[model samples]
Target: MDKIHLTFSQKIIVNVFRQVRIIKGNLVHQKYFFILKHEMQLSEFKYMIHDLGPYSYDLSGDVEYLLQNDILQKYDGQISVGNNILDKVDDIDLEEDEIEKKIAHISSFIQQLFDRTLVSEKNIELAGSILILLWDQEIYVKSEIWEKIKKWKPGFFSLIEFDSVWDILYHKKLISKEVYIPNNYIERLKCLNSGSKNAREYYRLIEKFFRYIFKNELNNFVLKEYWCDGNKKIDFSAENVAKKGIFKKMSKYSSSPINTIPILCKNQDRELFGSDLVESYELLNYEFSNIAFLTIRSFEHDQWILDEMTRFYRENDKKSIKKILFLLQDIDLIDMVEFRLRGIEPSGILKEKLRSVITNRNVVPCS
Candidate 1:
């Protein structure tokens, strides 16, 4: 028989099924495995950042073509290589001189991950998520990178134990060796939050704020300029589910959990303490998030703000998710970035302030 014709994406998909029979394989699995092409630049398909990580219609279309034409097949929710797998893989062997070495390396790695029961949508997506940020030159710190990935896919990572999977990928070298070290963090923060003129940029930097300071504690969605029915502008907001972090402990022990965290960014340093309290408190919808976060540089060591924090806590009132104002500051924006860059968890800083807040004492300064 003559050689079979295949599209670039078709050959790449075939190569994956050839090496391993992926159980529960589907489009998500296919797209993530296809990220292999992105790593080695094997395919020409371009992907946009989807909520589920990178996605490409070109790749999706080619997958449909291959399956419809029987170049690839899926049976019993198990995806394996087809009988006529890519005319011996020559078309996607990448460079003939390289002689399929890249695919070979990938197949071996996938097989190893499969053997160790590490191949899954989340694990592969984790690696791909890291690659995406590295490519954008957004972050290089491991802990910080992990935080950002969790923020992107919170619902997925929330219930899974993925630390072991990450160690294998990073410590064992599946991540690219060419690493980027960020140098503009301090200056970046200064420029973004310096004046009301840059408040828009500061709103954008709020995502950076969560990844840096919160460090996987809160899974946030940036909603700059989000408007309410009452027409008040919400500078930012986040998923109120506290991960297995300081906030989690607060939820478990204190029962004062927030539904959605509303964060507001300001231009000049003001004693934001309680200024927005009655407004934010009145703003809470009974069916939705019941708490708020106001951005401040430092918790002004005032007895009134201290009193405002304690006033909201009702030991027996589970319905009282409101008035739990968690104040974040500017120093944390810089300090936590450095902390996570060195692969440190910024939870200690959080714990310090939270402890003081819950105890209704003067909050510890972020150092």
Candidate 2:
């Protein structure tokens, strides 16, 4: 007979099957292995067999290979040692202790293989850090977390597939869902009571007030929320008003300047904005060309709240400072008192600083 050549992954799968057989004393459902694979972390697996090699292999692929080769049989959605391996299993002569030792040796070898297959240490660190955050929050929604993670480590994460990390963490049981209620009735009531009678109308009033106060300093300003292609909405946006014939006159010199600014606001019921807001910015940056400035504003009294939130994020998350600082720069703070006193005048100095920040970071402005 030709010698059966088992890959490192295949060998690990075979050992898992043997252990399951000893424990269950019957055929195991394929879903059992699937769930096991999803919830088992590489580190835990290493500890399981006293070996560090499991991380080097793709355990999922091994399961499929076993099923395909009939080394492990699947019937009625269940799996068991196949006829090909039944005789070998029956022929085993080793004592229980000896069998366990052999299994541990195999596991260590597999870990070695896994270590060889790893990406850079930095990539692993970032991936692990993000996973830990997701785990802590019990967040499983891929797109939701991916948007935030990308903002923090855009260059590194852009190259990774979110699903892959999700699968590994899921299999290891490192991340699981908990019942989450974003807002309770009391919280909702508070938001409703404190909220403006009509958010849209209130925004319109603010816009009118700013335009009236800064009539001399500002040419034109429109404030409204915009919904982009993905049905994603920008909380607040402002655009510069151009004098009649200004664009026509400037057409000869240059294209119309991108003057649209997206503002991230912190107010009651604003908790939903985190990931969704980031997603909107990403989409707008990629799809629109007229975005020139990004504004993050809150009431002056809420500065303490922002500071506390910043501290919480910095303590709980890795590289959060760089990400937050980049998004909400020192200049982006529009003190409610200051805005109320002076109105929204176009600040040439601030605009120049914003331009430099955007240019140096290679951030494509959004519409």
Per candidate, the number of residue pairs that clash is 0, 17
TM-score of predicted structure 2: 0.26
lDDT of 1 by residue, 1-367 (tens): 6655676556666666665555355534544454566557754566666666666777767766766766667787655556645554336553354535676677666566644555566665655565566554446665566677778877677423545554565555655433322224444665554555676777677666674456455665767555566653637666656667756654565344554566766655565646565555554443245455666555566567656665654331445332355556777666666676656777677667556556764444222
When summed lDDT is taken over every stretch of 10 residues in candidate 2, the lowest stretch is 45-54
Candidate 1 is scored at a TM of 0.43
Q: Provide the TM-score for each candidate, comma-separated.
A: 0.43, 0.26
* lDDT of predicted model 2: 0.39
Badly placed stretches (over 4 Å) of model 2 are 1-5, 20-70, 83-86, 89-173, 176-367
Q: Local distance difference test, per candidate? A: 0.58, 0.39
lDDT of 2 by residue, 1-367 (tens): 4545675446546766565542121212222232244344322222111011112134445656666767887665656567757443333223356545655554443333224432334433444544444543444334455666666556655534554555444444444422111111112222332243444533443344334333443344544466657543334544545443322222223343434434443223333344544553453455332333233322343343344334422342332111222233222322221333333333434444433443442222232
Off by over 4 Å in 1: 1-4, 21-24, 31-35, 84-97, 114-120, 141-155, 159-162, 176-367
Per-residue lDDT value at 275 in model 2: 51
Residue 92 lDDT in candidate 2: 28
